[model samples]
Target: MFVGHAVFAFALVAGAAAVRGVDSSRALSLGAVAAAFAAAPDVDMAYALVGVVSAQTTDALSVASQFWQTGNLVHRAMTHSVVLAPVVAVAAALWLRGRRLRRRRELVAAGALLASVVAIAAVVSGGLGLLIMALFVAVAVGIAEGTERLTDLGSRETFSTALVGLVSHPFGDLFTGLPPAMLYPFDATLLADRLSFSVDPTLNLLGAFGLELLTIWLALLVSLSLFGYSLRDAVDGRAALGAGYAVSVLLIPAPTLELSYPFVFSVLAVGMVGAAPRVGIRSRRVELPDRIAALCTGLAAVSIAGFAYTVAYLVA
Candidate 1:
């Protein structure tokens, strides 16, 4: 979901910028800034990581559960707040204003964004936790700086894009879980309940997982579209079908297996195969556009089939 957030943010900003007649290169740069901002909220997850590492968990599942539980305590609390966006943006702008200090603004922005988290973690988890979180902040800031550099966007453009991404990121969380405190500090009010479809194992695990896969595919579709590619260019129907077949085979229930394997594998398989070069002799090297189109087309076909199968299974 973290990657999804970044992809969605990039699509929105880059697509909007492109539509507004911005040059492709500049728009891409703005998208990079947006992607970085979208991912900034997750820096709070470092606290969860610290907790898991410090705990004496006996099993992998226990470790994972502990991490999830710890994360839920503060995942969308202050860092994900809409109110923090402007503060971080202003700090970033000031830091980047006159200095060509590559990515120094990103570091400043990340520090500003996570200041509250660090303070709280220092009190609740102690100095060690704070140090761990600070480490994660440094990594996040580095990523933001790297993204900006990759796009070659100016400081002002990057700052504006970051602001937009930060402002919009909290809303994206509404679909997966509890809504973020959009008006945090001032008002600790949740914006809305999470948007969820029934996916109880006894009822319809397939439907639930199918919906999740569809959401991811939709994000991928939007990303490709924003990059000026179409479904036809990214997907190969034959490859998608083959991938789907392989997934369906793997999805056949095995009582011997301990973990509950969901049908999302089929969707993933389709996407992977569709995105690859066609299994045929090519006269020349496959261009980027053609590869993307093949990938999208294959994924779309697999999604359609996967959804249909899920619906049919539920009805049966």
Candidate 2:
């Protein structure tokens, strides 16, 4: 799921681009909004996790003596429910709207969009768990388009692309110990238990190092492979680099992959999009940054040292 999440990010970026190509800017905005909406399930951990919520709040919430018996409040609760997806989405959109504006009319529009996503997610699943999540996104975006000030994609087009992006999230989550409850109400136990631990240090270092290396290496490879592909060509080279980046991510340890998956993939996806021209094949050749190489080397050194120290401490 670690590597899978990275793919999901890439897919989202691609979907947004696709949305931009066909629809108006406002619809594209809604697509971004949809992407954010799809990420809401993890909000259950908001009060507990450092990233989703905050460690301080999590600590405070779980400070009670009975915390251990609380059945992983964030891990396995309403957040994991398929039935709850719509509820959560609607609530979140409305809450965000409310928080942003005091107007009741604005809240109504936001809530409807959230509801639309729920239907999309369910019908889109069409029995495939992964596809359902994508459906959520498509519907959310499509509904958001209803309120668009600029332009919007036909509901069908938005629906299709959103599905492509939606399914990736659960597919990636599968690699982690916690898979999405894609069919929440029907299937309580979501995700196969192929991997253990949602966190691993070695995997984190590996992902961090591998992603950087592959992306840079692919850039070099394509340029060298082609007659005219140059260092300056940043755009066309990204897909190749993405493939390498994905491979590096897949090689990371299950636990570590889970831990660093979100941040690593997010950064890579955004970087790929922004740096496309610089890294694309259509652009002029440019030198790979020495800083990235140095960072990977440093990460490798630290990992080895940590491993050695852990072993020594254990032996002693």
Candidate 3:
């Protein structure tokens, strides 16, 4: 899976967490950081794809060839795994320390801006794109952490939220068909391909544009619905944030919502954060609950194994 796919998923979940005010700023920053971490694994292809001295066309592999070749370098490997997560995260955080501006908000915005740039560049040039992504997250986390340490924001909450964002990163990728190679020495397998190539382009454009359209529609409906509830007057902020999260999560099960789920969800999630209810949005947060999240994770693991088995059987 591409970094964008995982990044978008983490962004939505983390961003949603933030919008609800559960871990607002930290979650948002972590979302960006997770995106970077998700992206770091694929930076190697940078040499073959991106040109330096002169403008060069990056069409070394045909579509099918590209798909197959990805398995050689892109999938679960050195880049994707639990071991590399912290290593990459810390490196990214340190590098970003130099770019620190006075304002934390400004730092976050800059991190987002930088991440976007790297993602786009990777898509076009096709290098070790994930490295750029990793950098993006590092900067994001560093911005938040540095700011919290230096500024007035509570450090414990921000750090805790950032931890959540980081932990959730890999799980989101597994669902999107990109599992990190966290246990490299013990396990050598990379990824089990459950998705189609068509899903890629479709999700890309849809997420890039479709999300903007849906957010507006969803926002209007949510705002109107809140008019009738007595509690709406008190929980107006929470209601709006809930509505945004609902829209994002709802998009997950849609039939056409395949690879694009993360991106669409993320876009909607960011909007939801923007629309977040001002009260205790964080306290009233929505999560899958521990038991359910674990169950889902277990099922996902089995599914991947089954997918791999089927593929190997067919090949054999």
How well does each candidate superpose onto the true structure, as a TM-score?
0.70, 0.39, 0.36
Q: 1 or 3: which has the higher lDDT?
A: 1
**Number of the top TM-score candidate:** 1
lDDT of 2 at 220: 34
Better of 1 and 3 by TM-score: 1
Which stretches in model 3 have alpha-carbon errors above 4 Å?
Answer: 1-16, 19-27, 44-64, 67-71, 90-169, 173-179, 185-316
Quantify all predictions' global Cα lDDT against the true fold: 0.61, 0.41, 0.41
Best by lDDT: 1
Q: For model 2, state the Cα shift of residue 206 in Å.
A: 3.5
Error of 1 at 114 (Å): 7.6
Residues 1-316 of candidate 3 have per-residue lDDT tens digits of 3544444545454646545765444444454444444444444444323333233334532432444344445454434445434433443343344344355654555456546545543663356544644544545455555644554334343344344444444444554344555453334555554333244444434333433333322332232233222322322222222223323333433223323445444433333332322344668755432332332233233223223322332343
Decoy 1 TM-score against native: 0.70
Candidate 1: what lDDT? 0.61
Model 1 CA deviation exceeding 4 Å by range? 51-63, 101-144, 197-230, 239-270, 275-298
Candidate 2 C-alpha lDDT tens digits along 1-316: 2233333443354444544553334434444444443453443433333333322344432442123223234443333455555454454445344434566775676566555544544554433323344343444544444423233433333334334434444544444344556665464576555343224454544444444444334323322233233333423323333223333333433324324444344334434333322343676576453433333333333333334333432343
Model 1 agreement with the true structure over 1-316: per-residue lDDT tens digits: 5666777777778778877988777777777678787888787777787669877966865776678778877687666767756766654554444234655655555466667655654664567546644554454456445654465566677568778877877886776557887776554576567654454442244444454455556556556655676655445555435423433534555211123233444345555554555443566666433655655666566666665555544554
